[model samples]
Target: ASYPYKTTQQSCKARSSKVGAIKGYGNTLRGDEEGMRQALDTYGPLAAAIHTTTDLQFYGGSSSGHGAGIIDIPSCSKQVDHAIAIVGYGTENGKDYW
Candidate 1:
């Protein structure tokens, strides 16, 4: 036997109803660094998509015998392929990070 996997508008409605209504939603223009920073500063946090690099993929946290520091991939790519949240930003030792 096989089961069919499908989703309908009615099913979406039912599931959404159980979760309650969405409060608000907004977005910043693509490539607009200043706008993204402004939005983050104003709205608290924002969802962000970024290009993942080998350095980022293998980041070994603070317990890896290497203390955690800003992940600075100088040759980082520009193709966005991963989703992340921009909770906050700050400078450390004259370097900035999200």
Candidate 2:
């Protein structure tokens, strides 16, 4: 589904019947890439994080975002400042991406 970008905050107007429910939550082993990958393959997508960068801020832009490459930062560590779901992983143009 598509959501229009709103400049101001909007209150939730969703009907209770239409809202999806979360059953429960589980935590993946911390700082374990292989374990996270196996969990994603076995169960489903897991919440993960990546180091934010200025280049990532331009994700919506045309040229810079169109490349078939994976963004990797070797100096990045487990210090997460943001969170996102680990839906799936695959290779694009012979480069593995998440």
Candidate 3:
């Protein structure tokens, strides 16, 4: 399958605004902003980088337990499968992510 299943740069940017737009439960993580924040902090830089239309669409796909809609988080088990913006920074596995 082609990477970044999403169709365009506009759509790619749109996906980031949705928190848990990829969670397993519908609208779940409603109050877990901090948890997501912590995740971004430590793993943001490690998160994949988008440098092209292809890059933007690179991690697009429907994850399991994503519910009946498209608001479920990507699989933590799947590396480089979903696109997330790195708004924060930190280190993990000795990797410098920003």
Candidate 1 vs candidate 3: the TM-score winner is 1
- Per-residue lDDT, model 3, residue 53, is 34
How many clashes (backbone atoms < 3 Å, residues ≥3 apart in a chain or on different chains) does model 2 have? 0
Candidate 3 per-residue C-alpha lDDT over 1-98 given as tens digits, one digit per residue, 9 for 90 to 100:
33434344553333335454432322215335566566655544323423233423334333542232222233333234456554664565665434
User: Considering summed lDDT, which 10 consecutive residues are worst modelled in model 1?
Assistant: 1-10
Top candidate on lDDT is 1
How high is the CA lDDT of each candidate model? 0.71, 0.66, 0.41
Residue pairs that clash (backbone atoms under 3 angstroms), model 2: none
Report the lDDT tens digits of candidate 1 across residue range 1-98. Answer: 14322322334323223655558989888867788888988877898888877675546545752336788877646688988889888889999777
Better of 1 and 2 by lDDT: 1
Error of 3 at 16 (Å): 18
Ranking according to lDDT, highest score first: 1, 2, 3
TM-score of 1: 0.63
Write one digit per residue (lDDT tens) for candidate 2, span 40-95: 89878787777676656535423534332466545766566778888888877787
Query: Which of candidates 2 and 3 is the stronger one according to TM-score?
Result: 2
Estimate the lDDT of model 2. 0.66
TM-score for candidate 3:
0.22
